[model samples]
Target chain A: MTAAAEFISVSKRFSRRAKVRTLAGLAGQWLRGPKRGPDGLLPHEFMALQDVSFAVQPGESLGIVGPNGSGKSTILKLLFRILRPDRGQVVTKGRVGGLIELGAGFHPYLSGRENVSINGAILGMSRADIRRQYEAIVEFSGLAEFMDMPVKDYSSGMYARLAFAIAAHANPDVLLVDEVLAVGDAGFQLKCYDWMARMRTSGRAVITVSHDMYAMAASTRCLFIKSGQVKAHGDARQVIEAYLTDLSRDRHDPVLETNFIKTADGVPRAEIKSVELLDGLGRPVTSIGHGANLMLRFHYHAAEQVHSPIFALTLFHDDPRYPLNLPRHYLFHVFSGPAFADQTLKGSGTVEVLVEDVRLPVGCYRAKTYLFERDGVSPIFVQDGVARLEVDRPDWSDGRPLLEHRQRWTITSHVST
Target chain B: MSPMSITAELREVAGARGLAWMLASREVRVRYKHTVLGIGWALALPVALMLVFTFLFTRVAKVDAGGLPYPVFVFLGLVPWQLHANILSGAARCLTDQRNLVTKVYFAREALPLSVVLSALVDFAVAMTVLAALMAWYGIAPGPGLALVPVVLAVQLALATGLALVLSAANLLYRDVQYVLQVGLQVWMFASSVVYPIPRTGNLKWLAWLNPMTPILDAWRTCITGAHFGLAPEFGLAALISVVVLVAGWRWFRRMERVFGELA
Candidate 1:
């Protein structure tokens, strides 16, 4: 089968940050600036998409993942023909439905029904087709009761939901969605993902850009982009792993270790200088087990004198956007802050939160720690992103040392051989 | 795409009840929105202009009115000129006004200009009714030739719509077109037969005849007031120019459409 969308030697150039551009900013920039590229009779040009070529096959859900300002959205815009690429061609073989920023097409004064019809027509659905799907769209959007109300009155979620319903139901050959699922509540988001899965299974191609990693992993082949170039593209798992690994490298840490802490602004004043997981003899270890004795030591300093200070710690596994594991519910332990101890020397110390058996799922956990004053009168200092811990299943099967579990296989069959 | 498809799309635009209402209601609502005595301006401006033109043409210039009242003479021509001007100017910039609609979705961008033209039809209808009432009160009945008024009005509408298509597309590419059209329309207005009857006495009468609008407005006045308009030659030329302008505007728009989404 032919690919649904193909970008051939597509190069879009845009100027580097003159300033952050808003709609009003765009009006001024394009109006005053000398035009260049395309028709070279103009002057002063910038590249947005540069010499990039890629093709998306039928039934393939392609996720364009990148950090902010990486030109992921610009690719979507080009596909939608909102902005033309100066050099190369974007050949699309089918009816293209783009929800490039949901609610982008809705008029505020029009009622839901009116907007639905117009938006459907805009998506290339004929009037008869829109009429046929009108009820289905209203039902899918759950806006049947509010169909007559002006869209401006709808909340942002309602607006996005309605917009998605129209675009999805249009049954286009190629669909382009840009961060649309980010607007709705969790339930609606799940519903959208479910619909997208159906769209994939039915052989309609989908191109989506989202910061939602789970959704990206669930339904699509992923493309990782960095500064307008394709960094990685392949299986979802491999691509996501590579992307996360690459991103981890971007974090500037002098210690060459993944360390982190979470804090609530200034209230609980603590800065974790270092975090190291230690074994039974307090030796630093990179790997540990489910029932291993773990020491989470937080090194910190006091900016000002404090009467009494408390430490709050939490643990998270795998995902950076959400914290899913916590060994303690901020089990605050009080200690004398370094300020009051010695007059000549500033005070600093380490607080170790020891876990007898860390009951964490098999994954990496970044240690999150916070420190605060007890009286709640004043905030001294704060810091986040302390360090990292790696955990696994414990093995004491033959009464050998648990550390032997790192070996791939048992030695029982070797004696008979 | 076939012409049939384009026709169908235009029908879809016209048939859309909400769009129709929006086109009609917004024209009136927007015109009077913040102004005092909003809707009254619709009636007041044209009549006021007629009085000024009558004073200038009849009293100051001592021009003959061809045996009819000078106010009736100018009003007959002014109605068509005003309709054409409103439709042309409004339609030319219609696409620009709905900038949000154009970029957000892919419908026929032509709908914007068409909507503006349709909306102006409401104002035209209102003025036509007022014209009819004034003619009756003045004891002036539309001649047997009055049946041709719709055809004349249709020609003028065609001319305006064509100009609109061309200008709307042009405005997208060059921001300067709007300023150009504003000044051009003002000059074009006086050059047309809006202020005085087409001057048959002057050697320069052919200049007025060359203006497609003059024949159109003259045809309208001729149909309504039983004025001696040299119809056969003038109407023939008027029809030819209207077709050429309409087709040329459409062809230019179609050729330039690919750039509109980018530039607009």
Candidate 2:
């Protein structure tokens, strides 16, 4: 079978700092001699993609999985010819349709109906083809009532729906999808997935870049990239497992070695001395697979006799840059209750919380332990990032970890065929 | 491997002609939509400029218009000048305005500037109709020289396309190009014989001839007014300059095309 797209030892480098933001800056840089380094990059420049080779034949779906700034999107752009490789060749056989970003070619002032034709054309569809599929596009978007209105008037959801609808109808031989599936409501996302599955069955090639693990697992093949290089590539499940292990190992270094001290002010009624994340077998481990039992053990010391102390452990995803920005409820959990009601702790004691079936996805998470008085309002001692927990699940057949809900269903039938 | 020849680059653009037309029509529709004047706005600019120039030059300054009616002469020159100015200014910002598409989607980048120019042509067509009506109102009969109007318009298009390509590409690299082009266009208008006849006996005469637009604008006035329309050596020079600028600008644009996505 012919390949829809192929890259041969392709490498791309970008300046670490954009020196051409202004005309004056560009002129000044030109006056300076020999700014490039030995790698043909200017000083402080770095490689975005380094000697990466991949191919996707007809009827194959290739999923590119990587963390942010890992060159996954750069590969898609190179395949679409938006960026040229510096050291190698990229060949795309037939028409390429890209749904790389939400509403990429849409104009705000044009009507949703008009934008469909224009955006479709931009994605390589002919005017005649757009006309033929115009009704289907509008129907699929479910924006027929607002088709005549300018897109600027539509809500953001409506705009994204129309953009996705038009791109879905372009029907190119190879489809390149970025994280656009993360947009819209769950129902629309399911529709997009169904459409993609249909395309796959119809023998069209697909290259997808997504952080969603379930989507990657569903593809025919997966590539795990790190720091502009392919770390592993093969079955989606195995590659995702490798990526998760690498992520946990990278995150474990700081938390596992350092001893955190409780810094909250008060009379120091009690202090968290140590925290450990153990696996199902009770062995101290940094990483545990999803749906496996894990234990959170906190060692604490009391200054004096304390009654009804509250112990709380909150989990946080270990994204240091933009922590606590997104909805933190799922990644954060508070385990607070009456610890030893009517009992007194004079010296040191251990508090163990058994968490059954850890359903968190494959990523590094830090646990924060807090000890409070009986009121559970005022904290006596607080330890931030006390322990690191890495949840890994190689099997994504059940669906996304966050979206998966376990339930039991049964049906009784009277008639038999 | 050989470098991409100009013919090959042009053929690549031609392959995306459908997309260019769709984008151009979208621009035309969006610009005129929800407006009261509705494409009358196109003619309104040149006509308003004609009234202002006629009042200022003929009444206030008492400038000569070569014995032609000031309104007709100024209106004719303003028509093509307005077209050229609108196209250049719009095309200059075209890539910047569509930076979203430039960074996220892949298409022939020329489609953006070319579509802006094409959309301005629709406005030019509307303005031309009003100019023809004004000429009739002034009782200026058509002459055989009117056959050269297409040639004159073609030359003007060549000049506009060339400059638009160059300005749009430069504007993408440096935002200062847009501001510079705005100021430069004001000076270019005055030097192109839009208000007054070119001075026949001064150092400025050669300066006017050096501006390719001067002969093209003069040719437009001559064709409509039934004046002497013989092909002068200056006209040949203007045509040659327009083609050279067009080819050179296109080559430069293609050379810089690879970086536009990064810069935008």
Candidate 3:
């Protein structure tokens, strides 16, 4: 079978215009002749994608994982024909649909029903096709009762739901979905996943761009891109592992250390020197698997010793569904041994928190550290985002890695004649 | 670099006709959503302008209406002028107003300005009914030249679409185009023969003939009044100019289409 989409050694460059004094300067250049590079770009230009190539076969899903400004979105746009490749050929076999931005064509004053047809057409569906699938789109959105209401009055969740429903029903042969899965509620995301699975079973190709590890792992193959080049490709697990290793290397660079300190109440008597996340073998790591041994080590110095000092570590996940500052887990330990019992023990030391069989889900978490007195009312030294930890379940193939708890239950049936 | 030929671009635009229609209806629907008079506003503007011009020119300035009722003659001129002005202004800003859609989604870029022109046409069609009633009130019976109204309107649409495409694309590159257009429309209205007839014998006769809108507006008046209503050489010249603008402006617009997203 023919490939659903293919990019043959594509390269794209974006040019920056040099400031000219007036239209005369432009006219002078035109009279003198064109001064452009071989790639049609002027002197001041930046390469966005360089010699990038990939292909997606029918019924297969390809996930592109990359850092910001790594030309990930550019690839998707080229595939959708939004942007032409500067050098190389981009060939797509069939109808192309994009979920790049939800509710992109929705008018605030138009009713949900009206918006469904309009958005569907924008996604490349014919009017007759939109009419035929209109009821199904409304039914899938679960907004049948609110179809007549203008979209501006609807909550954001409802608006995204309606938009996604129309796009999902358009039935393109090749689908390109950006980082839109992070929107809406968890149930809606699962619904989207189910729809994608159905599309795959029906032999359609999919290309997804996301930072979410779980979503990348669910795809059949993955590409790890950095600085407009493909560092690794093929085998979702291997590519993801390579990506994680690269991330850890970047984070652990000595020059890249984060200086998180909160000394608002004057220079505190205590200071947190450094923080590290360790794996099962006591090796420093930036990511950990679910139900694995993990350790968090904090190094600190105290100028003046205090009694019954409390050390706290808070883990926060920047969940798109909630406020940024909310912490997912909190742990507070009071040092009551000889280290803290002394009335005035001034020295430097290390504190370690060893967790066995970690159950945190697959997502990036930030650790915050604080030192307080015995009463735990006043904080001596507080630091936010002292360290970062990424949790994952590399073994799971389907469903999100949300938890690791196991349940024990038995069912019994009783019948009476 | 050129991505596709003009024929290919036209084919792509043809494929997006459904989207253009949907967008046009959306513009019409949203404009009248909360208004009490709904489509009555479309008629009110031309009628009000006609009344003001009739009082100012026919009475105050003592300008001749070519022996025709000044109200009917001015109404005929005002209807098409409003169509041209509304379409050009709306199309000039359509791309900027939908910047979000332009940057995020992929569709035929021509649809943006074309839909604005189409929506303005709906308003023009509605306003023409009032023109019909006014002509009947003056007892101006239909003539053989009435069939030629469509031809005149077609030429006007061609001219407007060409100018709209050029202005919209240029506006994206430099916003000064929009401000210039606002001030330019005021001057352009007086240059055309919308309010008073051009003097047959005067130093200003050459100026009137030089204005492309003059012949088009004169052709519309001739068609409505059925006096001196045969095909004029000036009308043919106007048609030729409209075609030239349409072709050249379309080529320039297509060449600049690739950079619109980045500039926007």
Candidate with top lDDT is 2
Question: Which candidate tops DockQ?
Answer: 2
The sequence of per-residue lDDT tens digits that candidate 3 reaches over residues A1-417 is: 788998888988876664212345656868988667886766777788888888899999999998888989988888877677778889888888858878878999999999998899888889999989999999999999999999999999999999999989989888999989888888999999899989988999999998777778999999989988889989998998898778766754222223322345555577666777788677999778756777667676766654565566666663331222334353222232333433332466666666666666456676777776667666777777677777664455443433333221111121211
lDDT of 1 by residue, B1-264 (tens): 112366764564455544434444545555665678766667776888888988898778976666777788788777777778887778667767766666655555666676677777777777777788778888998899888877887788778878888988877766667777789989988887777666755786886668888788778778888877556687778888988898888767766665555565
- Of 1 and 3, the candidate ranking higher by TM-score: 3
Segments in model 3 whose C-alpha atoms lie over 4 Å from true places:
A15-44, A253-305, A315-357, A362-369, A381-417, B1-5, B200-202, B229-231
- Report the lDDT tens digits of candidate 3 across residue range B26-57: 99999998999998899999989988988898
Clashes of each: 23, 0, 0
Candidate 2 chain B, run of 10 with poorest lDDT = B226-235
Model 3: DockQ vs. true structure: 0.42
Label model 2 with its docking quality class: medium
Pairs in clash, predicted candidate 2: none
Q: Model 3 chain B — which ten-residue stretch has the worst lDDT?
A: B225-234
Q: What overall lDDT, based on C-alpha atoms, would model 3 receive against the true structure?
A: 0.78
True contacts kept of 3: 0.38
Worst 10 residues of 1 chain B by lDDT: B1-10
Considering the two chains of model 3, state its CAPRI-style docking category. Answer: acceptable
The digit string of per-residue lDDT tens for model 2 on A291-381 reads 7766767777877655776677777776432222356534646454643566556677676766666676555677777777777776777
- Candidate 2, residues B100-217, lDDT tens digits: the string is 8888888889899889888999998998888778878888887887897899889989989988999898998888988999999999998878877777467887855688888888
